[model samples]
Target: MSAAWVLGKRALREGRRTPDALLPTLFIPLFFLVVNVGQAAKIFPAASTEFLHGQGYGAFQLPSSLLLAASFGTAALFLVEEIEGGYFDKLRASPVPRSAIVLGRLIAELVKAVAITTVLVLLGLAFGISIASGPVGFVLLVALTALWAVVFVGFMQIIALKTRSAAATNSAGLVFFPLLFLTPNFVPRDLLTRPMEIAATLNPVTYVMEALRSLILEDLEWGTIAPGFAVVLALGAVMLALNVRVIQRYD
Candidate 1:
């Protein structure tokens, strides 16, 4: 655990020094939030949109933006850098446990997620959005978002470890775009076409988005919220296990 902590701190320090690496992670999402709200705010005004629960379209769309922000993690890219520079090999040969290597990166991702989620939430508030579940929901929202980020970064790390190529690792992140759009980003799931609805239902990301949307547009709906956390936990377990196994077997 101590070794993991040290490596996590190191990752945080490196991230701090390379703020440029985070610009896209932050900007693209914020841009999407602004653009989506601008384009759809009138069509789905808070006064009329049944699904929005009296909140503007921004509130409904905020979760999608939050998920998008979490998806743009750079941990795997950094891991690729380390691999290329030979530092990762040194760590593998050292006394540090393989699990710590993976945990350390995830720890850094949790911190990053918290900061990004806070910023997006504040921005959402400024745009006339509020958490219907209030302070408690706010806490859960941050926790869930951070957990998703850690899980996502873990998956990205798997790509980094398996491919050992920065370009492939970075490019693979684009696959999330389809996952993002397949969800009910602009409206409720029932409103989607039959085919689209089925696809959204199958996409685990949909549950996470709805869980976040529930927090913003309605009060604590445990039924809605539970599924999001469940998906994150299940996905996190798989991603973490795969990450550790990949690192352990890496030549």
Candidate 2:
């Protein structure tokens, strides 16, 4: 555990110090936030706009950026480079536990994910977005976002371990995020078309979005918040276990 902390700190530092790590993750969601809101506001109904007055369209779609951007950790990308350079083998030869290797990278990604989310949240606030749940909801927002990011870290690392290929690791999110975009990304689930509404109802990302939307756009209700964390927690555990096993069984 001590070694894991040490590695975790080092991993975190590496992530922080690298500008590239922040750029790609930060750019996408932020870009989407601005673009989506800019276009949607022009065409959206006044009642809908009035309904989301505090954060407006930006606040409502804020999770689109928050959840999507923070969710993709470059841990796998780093692992790929390390594996190619033989540093991964050196770590394997070291006394650090296998779980530490995986968890350490995960910790680093979590830190990065949270940092990115915080910056974006602050940026949203700068544009007049308010936190619906106040201080407490802000904390929950960060934690829940980090939990979701952790799940992604596990999935990405599994790709890193099994394929050990930069190409494969980088493409992991490509396979998973379409469903996220298809969810109530542009509007509330209730506002979605019938087929899309049904899809959003079934999508876990919808719960994650509504959970976050509650903090920024709606009243914070356990009814909304709890389910998001519950789903992420349940899913995060499975991803964590699978990544741990992959690491433990690695040759």
Candidate 3:
């Protein structure tokens, strides 16, 4: 336990030293938020009246923006860095349990994810977006966003450890892009074409969008949020198991 805390603290310190590593996690998402919101604003008002449950497009899209901001980049970047720099080997040689190292890294990523979400959420409010779901919804947004970060980290750790290359890990992170686009994010799922509709139906990110939209624009719709959280938790378990297998194989 003490060892895990030490590892997590060390990871946080290391992250602080390299602002470049943290910048994309915040900047890229902000760029997307600005571009998407601006380009869609003209038409979004008309479209929002049809299926937005009486919310503006800016409000509808804010949750997706927050999620993107919190979710960009990989905790695997750190893993790959440590491995290439030989720091991972040094840690592996220590007497600490292997799982502790990964857990510590996961904890650090969760912290960072929450911080990013907070900043973006504040920005969303600054832009006049309001959370209709109130306190419960706000808490769930934060909680689920943190889980999203940790779940992605679990997958990232698998890729980083299995490939042992920072470049490869970075490339692997792009796989989420298609997943993000296929979701009911920018537009209502009802408005999507056949192929996109099918893809969005199958995409886990769609549920996340639904959950966030429900919270940000609706009145505490527990039905959508519950299943959305279930999906995140289930994915987190699966990815964690996969990462654990990788750690056992390599460590």
Candidate 4:
């Protein structure tokens, strides 16, 4: 078998065997979706503001939950599993191209992201959350989610390759929240605190949130979506380079 196939199968098997690995990807987003959407109206009185650039709280916060499921949650689990299983070491020693190992993990992360998004989309539909930009915008939303999964997972893999400890992986996962919360996630960008405004200005997650907001809220603004997608690709490349170096240095 090809090395990519071997590594891919390994990832698939590990994912299936550990319910914990996949369960959070399914439930955490759903839980947050329900809780946040329920409270957004009550909490963010300005959600009704047309100047905010999003429809309402539910649609506004949906991308954050989706991105969390795609990156922070599932990426942590995958890293922890690889560390616990000593699969990273095994892959390092194998004759397979290093890219195969990385690609396999990226593929696995994408699958997990898709599953999470699919479930959330169904829930959103049930709650009457339709795409504002028509069918193309809806497709872009899914594409962006998957793309973000690839880039974010690559970034996490770089951390995982260096740390090689579940505890450290967990710590690294927590690092995402500051970036996530500092953005215009629940509240609109116009209502952000000064510190939050600065943080959101620097955060790549903000770009993604903005892009998703544009699509789902029927606000077809390429100015918002393009930068987010571009940054995702740019960051992915840097992370992939770091991952390659870490793997090469693996003892």
What C-alpha lDDT does candidate 2 achieve relative to the native structure? 0.82
TM-score, ranked from best to worst = 1, 3, 2, 4
**2 or 3, greater by lDDT:** 2
Cα deviation of 37 in candidate 2 (Å)?
Answer: 0.7
| lDDT string, candidate 2, 1-251, tens digits | 88777888988887878887769888888888889988987666545565574456777888878888866767778888888899888888998787888888888777877787888888988997889889888988888888888887788888889998989888886855776867888777778899999888888878888898888866678899999999899988898899879888988
Top TM-score hit: 1
Q: After superposition, how far is residue 209 of candidate 2 from its true place, in Å?
A: 1.0
Q: Please write out the lDDT profile of model 4 over residues 157-224, one tens digit for every residue.
A: 77777777767776777777777888887776777888888888888888888898788876578998
Better of 1 and 2 by lDDT: 1
Residue-wise C-alpha lDDT for candidate 3, range 1-251, written one tens digit per residue: 78878888888887788888788878877788788878887786834476566666677777677667656556688888889999999988899988788888888888888888878777877877777888877878877888888887788788899999888888888877887888987787888998999999999988887888888878888898988898899998998778777787894
Model 1, stretches more than 4 Å misplaced? none
lDDT of 1 by residue, 1-251 (tens): 99999999999998889989987778888899889989988888778778989877888889988999999869999999999999998888899898898899999999988998998898788877899999999999988999999988999999999999999999888888999999998989999999999999999999999999999888999999999999999999999899889998988
lDDT of 1: 0.91
Off by over 4 Å in 4: 43-48, 51-55, 73-80
Error of 4 at 207 (Å): 0.5
Ordered by lDDT, highest first, the candidates read 1, 2, 3, 4
TM-score of candidate 2 against the unseen true structure: 0.94
Looking at model 2, report the run of 10 residues with the lowest lDDT sum.
46-55
Which stretch of 10 consecutive residues in model 1 shows the poorest summed lDDT? 45-54
Of candidates 2 and 1, the better by TM-score: 1
Pairs that collide, model 3: none
Candidate 1, residue 33: the lDDT equals 88
